[model samples]
Target: MRFAAALTAGAALIAAILSPETALAAEAHELPGAAMSLWWVLPFAGLLLCIATGPLLFHHAWEHHYGKIAAFWAALVIGPLAIAFGIPSATQAVLHALLTEYMSFIILLFALFTISGGIFVAGNIHGTPLVNAGLLLGGAVLASVIGTTGASMILIRPLIRANDNRRFNAHVVIFFIFLVSNIGGSLTPLGDPPLFVGFLRGVDFFWTTVHLLPETLFVAGVVLAVFLAIDIILHHREEGAPKIKDPTPDTKVRIRGLANIPLLAGVIAAILISAAWKPGVSFAFQGVSLELQNLVRDAAIMILAFTSLVVSPKEFRGANAFSWGPIAEVAKLFASIFICIVPVVAILRAGLDGALAPLVLLVSSPTGAPDNLAYFWLTGALSSFLDNAPTYLVFFELAGGDPQHLMTELASTLAAISAGAVFMGANTYVGNAPNFMVYAIARHRGIKMPSFFGYMAWSGAVLIPTFLLAGFLFFR
Candidate 1:
């Protein structure tokens, strides 16, 4: 894989340097297009090619899971550097800038630490549908207070433990992701980054909550209904599994270490302060300040909040069966995702204005485009594979030109971006960072999880429809 990336880099460098001036000019001035651009399609094509050649290249290792490694190597190593040389200079500039920016790194680190905290806290929970649901409900509210990433990290292990007895508890975690980790956070600027971005764009923080609550409730209601039905079925299935006698009744329920609550509170306070703090606004400096603030807050929370975890007695930690395994898994796998998506994000941003002319022309048309549902679907589809944050930015910037119906267009566009990125993020193992964390944590606790393809089948059967319905309700 490294050799392939080196080859790709060599080819891209040759293309960039040796091409004629006319060719370079053609590359620079090429029509704004989607999918058609080599920048967008080439990497995907290479992924497919890698999948096809996986068997031939790895031979015996092919049977042992080499495909994932090859794909990862291609994406992390070859993907960015190749596109930097192959794509126009503009695309290269954005990718390069994002890589160097410590804000992105800090944001990612915060996510990592948040996962760690969640694993530790949630590990104490035992697998029971009621307990799990309670934990998730608490997580949903906490997510708004501490940030979704933080809540996810702090609660995921507990949620996993709460459902440990039921094999069919995927639905529990699925709904957890849908509600607690994603949609529930819409009400606060501290809740989700997209809303936070909106806050920075002149929208007041409280106003965001006022406007978002209805949508959040609507989504939550539907998800809760689905969860109840699935949990009932799983409960019936659990009756058939072997049951062990309880040796210690309710000993695990004792709240001996209630002191940790204050530490958790400290974490939340730090996050709120960080979110509210600003060095005023500057067109140039706003980006830098926001990014730096996130870093400071992330570090503060990790350093300060962990004191509680450390001071808690061994019994409480043992009851939760807490360990560092799940967070470690999340860190290892997500690095590939964060790095690989850089080029895809750059290409999407570069092309959003030019490609999908039918949609773009309409958005620019006097009648205005019909909310570009096609663009919504396309963005949603790619967002399933790419990090949805950048995907949201791509479409938000794409719809920026519609000044005549700016509010309506921007609202529709934002709705689509938010819905697509958040909802479709459940589509695969790598679809969202936390999805993999949940899966890994579940597996480590002896819960048999579906395979990658198995998970997609489940998602296709269930979540895809929910996503489609969400798109209709929100986008229209």
Candidate 2:
């Protein structure tokens, strides 16, 4: 019966996509009007189907391999939809928006250098309370500048490697996600993709920091306190147990590759340049106004920064122990997300495009807040399971319709989305792009990581209450 219903729905989507009204409108740009109506639901269904098929598909595989299956299913569903409905030119516009308008490369490059620097100087500082505290602190701070993914890739493996001698370190990584990977991205546009989209749409960049600072600090402080308590308890357990003689250190803790400071500065400059570039042309392309200046700026900066990274030497990354695996993982997962969600994004764009005023009213508060922080939390919750970047763009375009509300509201709401997506991602390994990558790498090295539901339990116990507190404090 369910299969029959899905077939009917699929047929209806085909008709909707091919409807004469849409076809004529989309002909010039080849925007795949026929595929747009049902794009969102298809991948969503595929995600669920993959979850449902888990037992049959990877029964013999390790539990962690479920994500690979999920990624596969998502891509499989995306391929047919792309062929049937994709408009390459419009798709290029979307990609341009993603790359240039959002300045994603800026964030990626910033993360590369920042993570490398953190690893280079602090990589060996593990196993002691001081080192753990520093890592947690450094990770939190870095999360704001480089993003949760950047911070996690640079830190998680080294952290696991450092604490290999301890039996009670499982919970440490769990809490690490809460603080460093998820919650910390709340402060700036570079911290989370959703907020960056908001910025591209005209939300003031500085306001993001000002509006979200309080909530971010609160979450970080609480998570840190919880982590410390757990660490103390675990540290004693290890101390009381047997200890093996340790090998002597080869070199002291002095910072190596200090000369890379210029390269590091170059990375930051590249990010600033990319982000500071503004789109000058605002004329409509296929009925949608292209923010050309902003797009140009974002694309240029990202290109330069990444190009610099490609040209730099191996010695500059020595202490950081930088490698390609984590970034490759991020690229793979994001590729899946980008392709699978394209239809969904286009569908949402079409649905909400004509209904902007009403949609804004529907999402807004009684005060007619230009944008509501409440919507951020709702989207963020769903984003924990789905993809947050496109989810962010969905809400961002919705918010762009209203120009009358105070700019502060827009900043606050965008910040809320950023916080919610990054933080709640700790709820499940699959919640954020890098969460599972960290899990896979950690487990491969023999860390006894939590299961999907197990991670959720941790989030429920620790992060959820904190997010609720943030909602009351900020969203209201």
Candidate 3:
């Protein structure tokens, strides 16, 4: 049923691409952000809070009826929007968020998940201190290449298996989320969604690579060093205690599903081609306008994902323990998130005239200059929970929304925003799609992973001080 829906959607999109320009009047159907009160954002806030507390507070109910909970929160926003803004206006807002924002976001993550899951690491190795660090480093590098989703999916099972013998291994997964899933993706747009959002908005592909290198190194280096130190102590402690039998101690480390490698490259090429091939052709669904290049890119990527399913052996995916549940969870939760974020984004678009004026004020100095330090912290803080991509977009516009200006003269501020959005996503489970996915995968493997707040405690202890020092060193 899901496959048929994907094909139908692809066929309709291709037909739309082939049809004559059907854009709906190229007019801005913007909500009145200035007039909307803070109360309008309650659904968004409430939904996020429920996401954080639901599992810990009511495990069985949340597990079974999370979708219903998500729908309830979405209705809270949608029902009110219809009452206050009229059905047409509210429908357009919700449709725009779903069709434009949520569609592409999920497609990217879905493609990465599908393709990478086929490329199984067939065996596990011992989790020595240096060995774990090496895996983290390798995954970090790969995150920028194939994206965080790809890197996490390809490496995580082996990582778990490697440490399955260890008594204390949850910290390993914690640092994996920090380094591989979030921090490592800073170097390229392919690495993280927020950077990709910037790219579509006209930021140069290499802009973040050049600007964020030093900051990326500083944070990655510090966290990695911390992981090494902790792993060493834990390794020594485990040696003194009775040894836990290694489950897969006999098999040697090897890579399977080699056929999927070129498909991964195809995914990258599709994204890059979309960026370069503008084509000046676009179609609209109601008020939302999507460019021709983007639609083609998505369809092509989905094709590649389908191709992986055809070519890769089912045994490889079985060995990796790949399942559709994690992506489904992400899809459902973020659908609610994107829907709830509509009014919040509208209010942000209102600038100083809106309810978040105090927040809008902080990113600037008293002299009306772009404060790099403030931009870093503010972008990072919001990104800790909110979708970093849109959070980055909001601040990108707040920083004047000019790609050339942001890339050149206001480079420091742009760097701060980019750094914050990419780096600080590690601060919470829901900060990026992959953060929660990685958490889900680890827990499903029987690792007693931390709760939402417990994960925050880890990030709060490790990431906060690192950001403070790095923020002062560079952005300040």
Candidate 4:
């Protein structure tokens, strides 16, 4: 997997240096999104649907062929696009997406996943309700610092170990997903992919911090309060039952692989530096412009991640039970998603003239103003099913792709979109990557994690009403 990531980075460098010019030209060719019909989006929808249903409907086939299924859907879009528009046009769009969007996205995820895997939280505490809540709260805070995936990977095993003796422990893991894996990631670009996508598109680094703080606090606080109440009740309920033995005895909690902490800091530093240091130098290939600072950021992050691998002990990684499978799956599936998103982005850019005009109107007020509440719900609804990053891009484009305007005049609208995308990703397991990863880790550690739909039932009963209150209170 290291070889694969290195090879990919090497290939990108090779491609950039080898053939610098092409018939695709320097300027981007615009696709006529307004001219396209609804059928153009079928492949995108197909891929998303397959992603949603594949695991449950056919676990064997999905586990084996999800990449192929994603490719098939992507090819459906790419093929017809080439025939409909000239090959150069299609090539330009897809290449731009790959070079500009997908490259940095996957690199950041890979770097974080690699670095976080090296840090082993090597002890556990007894699962008192207060202790469980403390861990969840601590993780929720840590998530904004080291990304949801990183935080989840670092803390989930310890969390599971803490709760192993508790009979009613699934709810703890579920709320962890709700808080740690989704809502907790709202404050920073380093926290989640959706916010990072916004950063790449020119959102200010502190924008979410300034704008979404109240909403994040409201939602997280409410959810935490609910968790405490339920956990207390469940803890009491377990008191009457025959005792279950604690497999992992509680010990003084210690963190192994302390070296990775600095590497994680390096990643955060790299992103901050990139945002601050715009050298105005860029490389152009097939009409895609790769900025110098972004290139340097990705390179620096990869280096830091690799450095963690070398610095951290092998036994620490084994103790952490780390594997590259989760990030690898994400890399493949998101590549296909980015390819499929080309025309959809074009359609969104067309605004009221496009096939998705109804969707646009649905999120708009009668006076044609952007409806903050509607933006919250609509972006959240799609985000709950499809991946939040792309779902964010969809609404970000819908709300007008200008980050400057979004930062000021329609700040609330952008806030709504951002809040929705980040917060509602907790609504289902498939909504965000770390949700399923945490579930998988818990189940492997012998915690009875709920089934996919059963997990949604948990979210539905808890999260939906919280979101509704938040939508009305903040967005309205």
Candidate 5:
């Protein structure tokens, strides 16, 4: 059934690409945001809720039918949109999301996942507090280079293996999500999806690195300290107990799949080339504009992924336990998310005059200026549940869509939004894509992982205070 659905979706995408009806007309009529009501947001909200609860409440059913469930919610929006705004408008909207946003998003994830999956860390070391903290620190730095997904996949197994002899190690994986999967990604656009969306929207590729440095360092430093403290206590707790037999004992560390290292560098260079080399040429399809550089970037990334597959030894992938399942799940779920998000983004773009007027007001000060603090919390809070990429977009527009102005005059506001979206995503397993992947992998490896709510409790105790302090010191 899943394979059939994928084939159907692929066919639909191809048909949409080929149809001349997709060409943009001279006077394109956009769906007026002011005319749409808050009710239009229900489908998007419902889809997210289903994602949050489905695994916990109905694991068997959800595993088998999540794609169908996503489709059902997407239809609720598309069907109503066509009825109210006409089929052409509805088709344009869906095409815009799929072609423009979803394609770039999924391709980047695919490249990162594939290339990182080929690079396996061979051998393991004992998980002392110092060793664990060092691994977390190294992974955090690597996250900005390869991406949170890439860093997590490359280091997670070794970290797990190092601690396999420890009795109390769930906290180790929990902190891994906090640092490596979420906060550490704040430094580069390639590190996290939300920042990449910012990049595609005209923000400079290096803007995040310059603007978010202080916040990233402060938050990452504090979190690493917290992890060290907690890990120390836990390490002491298991001191006297007979250590479990180490499956992969300590050995000199060596890395396999060395060929993929160049491929990974190629991926980064491709992104830089795309950003820097623009010919000012674009192809428009039915209101969706495809730029030449972006097309080149996506093509280059796919080539890199394919190169990794060919050059890297199959045994390396097997050692890394690579499978297509995680990327496939991300592709299916995010396709629907991007589609369902169209109306919600429109409503948000409408601002104070639209149905989401209360949201606009909440993020503004009495002087009518944009509130950096509110932008931080609201963007972070929504990102904790909704996908952070769109959540960042909504607030990015709310603060004014001019990237030049954001980078210069309102740099603090942009930094706050970036920090919130990246940091607070660790609040739950579903907050970020890598968070859930790490959770599933840990559980499969026999860690007694926390339940959804249980994980939130951990974040609430550890992260919320840290964020509050950071907000007070920085965003305020």
Candidate 6:
């Protein structure tokens, strides 16, 4: 009843604010970003803080009521926005986010989650350092093809099962988060949400593949090396101690659920088609416009998700231990995030003339050129805590919103932003969605995964130095 009431009230408020007459009027008048103050960003800050702290401090309450908490923040932002900028402008902003950005973003994630959930890796191997490194390397390569979430879901259990006999294997999962969940996703838009957002905003699909290669290899290689060294030492220690009986003895690895592989390919094709087949056709709702290709892509992805559900054996997903909870949580939280971020994106677009002029100045050199290193670090620092997708959008706009200009002239800056957002997401479990999912799955399988701070300590010691080296070599 409460959920229904909230939904109805939200719909009513949007209807009142987005009435056709008001929308038309609001189109003519715009929010003055220059006049806006940092206080305007408080709601966005509040929402992120809640996301960061809520699960840690109040797990039960946060799990049940996170959607409501998100809605509360969205209402706070929307009501003030409607009053201050007039309902039309606010309506247009909200519609633009919902109809365009949020819709595409969530749909792609849903398709990836569902399709990947259907494909289970069905084998066990010994957790020798060489075998573990091979698994990590394979997952890293697969991440760019199947997405970090997809790759993680398919490979995590087998990796866990492989290491089930090992005494010192928590580090293996930690390094998996660093490599498979974050760094490996650098090569393609499908690999990470930030890159996909870049793709949707007009960056070419292969741009990340070509541009981020050096950084990705460096980070992944270094992390893999570190894992190998640690695993060797741990293996030696285990040899000295009493041998624990192995569960799930080694066997030739085999791939299961091959049917969903084609569906996963279909999802990739749909995105590619959307990017290439722009009919220039669009549908308008109130003040929002949905382009033909984007609409087609989203519908295709939905169909693919449904097809996977129907055709893939139910036991495949069951063996994979798939559940809807993660995707549901993401959908609810990001709905509010997209809504609350409207003002923030606008302010950023406003650039030096906007309320965030100080931030704008920080990323620019005295000669007015962007500081690429600053772009990498700041984007990375924020991405380490906040979600990386929105953080990427923020910096992408700060560099200037012209895709052509960014791709042609300031390509390094764009690469830096993409790398920072994708790679540093390993710095914390909450830094990226897959990081936490992998952690949860490992914990559920009885791995003594580190505490939140304990995990950060791992990242701080290993990843920070590695990123610094890569940034100096590549971004500099």
> Would you list the C-alpha lDDT of every candidate in the order shown?
0.56, 0.60, 0.88, 0.83, 0.84, 0.83
For residues 326-425, what per-residue lDDT tens digits would candidate 2 score against the true structure? Answer: 4554454455555555555555566434322243355666785644556657566657776666666666655663422435445566566566666666
Q: Candidate 4 — which residues are off by over 4 angstroms?
A: 1-28, 197-204, 390-405, 443-448
| Residue 338 shift from truth in candidate 3, angstroms | 0.9
Best by lDDT: 3
In model 5, the worst 10-residue window by lDDT is 18-27
Global Cα RMSD, each model:
5.9, 6.1, 7.7, 7.3, 5.9, 4.9
TM-scores for the candidates: 0.73, 0.73, 0.93, 0.86, 0.88, 0.85
Which 10-residue span in candidate 1 carries the lowest summed lDDT? 281-290
Q: Please give the distance, in angstroms, between residue 381's alpha carbon in candidate 5 and its true position after superposition.
A: 1.7
lDDT (tens digit, per residue) of candidate 3 on 72-131: 889877766654555667788999889878998899888888889898886668899999
Q: Please tell me which predicted candidate would have the highest TM-score against the true structure.
A: 3
lDDT by residue (322-415, candidate 4, tens digit) is 7777677877887897888787777766778887788778898888899999999988987886668877988998888899999999999999
Give the alpha carbon lDDT tens digit for every residue of 107-187 in model 6.
Answer: 877887888888777667888999999999999999998788878877887888888988999999999999999899999
Worst 10 residues of 2 by lDDT: 351-360
What residue pairs are clashing in model 3? none
- Candidate 5 per-residue C-alpha lDDT over 1-476 given as tens digits, one digit per residue, 9 for 90 to 100: 99978755754553343222333421245666666766677778888778777878998998889989999888777766654565778888899889878898789778978888888888877899999999999999999987888888788888888898899989999999999999989999989989988997889988999989999999999999999999999898888888778777667889988888898889888987887788999999986789999999999999999999999899988876677876777778878888887877777777877777888898889998879999999899878877788889889988988999999999999999999999999998768888877886787677998877788889999999999999998889
Error of 1 at 357 (Å): 6.5
Off by over 4 Å in 1: 1-36, 39-135, 240-249, 252-295, 305-318, 352-366, 370-379, 401-412
Instruction: State the displacement of the C-alpha of residue 252, model 5, in Å, after optimal TM-score superposition.
Output: 2.4
Screening candidate 5 with a backbone cut-off below 3 angstroms (N, C-alpha, C), the clashing residue pairs are 22-286, 23-286
